[model samples]
Target: MARVLMYTTAICPYCVNAKKLLAQKGVSVEEIRVDQNPQLRTEMMQKSGQRTVPQIWIGELHVGGFTDLWALDKQGKLDGLLQNN
Candidate 1:
């Protein structure tokens, strides 16, 4: 298993859905709530180049938002990324 980091806001539906999907996949995540932390939000944007609520990183791979994450899972690439080989 790899380290999962997610930059998320409190009221984002996509963030909730992303977390649920990750839970279903049995992946433990470290969530950073950027809604209250401006610095983290800025860091997330700088790191991912996306001004989005859910900025997910499976190890060093930027997995993008909820839709992108789901696409990876559907393509069966998410698990491999999570394994971080």
Candidate 2:
């Protein structure tokens, strides 16, 4: 499996959904709660170019948030990405 990192905030519905979906797909994600750490939030924005909560990175690929992730899954590309292929 690819390295899955999520920059999330506490009480974020999208983040919760994203996690659930990834879990359902059998992917274990490393979650970085930006609400608890300002530095991580800055790093997330710099790395992803997005200041939104629930910024997700699959391996080295910036997969965006819940909407982007679901779109990839809908297109059947998420699994391939998760496998790092």
Candidate 3:
């Protein structure tokens, strides 16, 4: 399986949902709290090209936010991504 990384804030519902979805897949996420560090938020923006909480990376693949993650799952593509296939 691939490593999961997420840029999230303390009170973002989307972030919570994203975590829940990943958890359902039996995946562990390394969360970076951008709310605690302005610089980290900036880095997240730079990498994701979006100023949004719950910016996710499954291995080297950028998965955007909760909506994108959910879409991928609905399309039956998220598991392969998580498995690094």
**Better model by TM-score, 2 or 3?**
3
Write the number of the candidate with greater lDDT, choosing between 1 and 2. Answer: 2
Report the poorest 10 consecutive residues by lDDT, candidate 3: 76-85
**For every model shown, what is its TM-score relative to the native structure?**
0.93, 0.95, 0.97
lDDT of 3 by residue, 1-85 (tens): 8899999999999999999999999999999999999999999999999998999999988989999999999999999999873
lDDT of 3: 0.95
Query: How many backbone clashes are present in model 3?
Result: 0
Q: Write down the lDDT of every candidate, Cα atoms only.
A: 0.90, 0.92, 0.95
Q: How accurate locally is residue 40 in candidate 2, as Cα lDDT from 0 to 100?
A: 86
Question: How much lDDT does candidate 2 score?
Answer: 0.92
Clash pairs detected, candidate 2: none
Question: Alpha-carbon error at 34 in model 1, in Å?
Answer: 0.7
- The prediction achieving the highest TM-score against the true structure is 3
RMSD of each: 1.0, 0.9, 0.8
Q: Write the per-residue lDDT of candidate 2 for residues 33-53, one digit (tens) a residue.
A: 999989988999899899997
Give the candidates in order of TM-score, highest first: 3, 2, 1
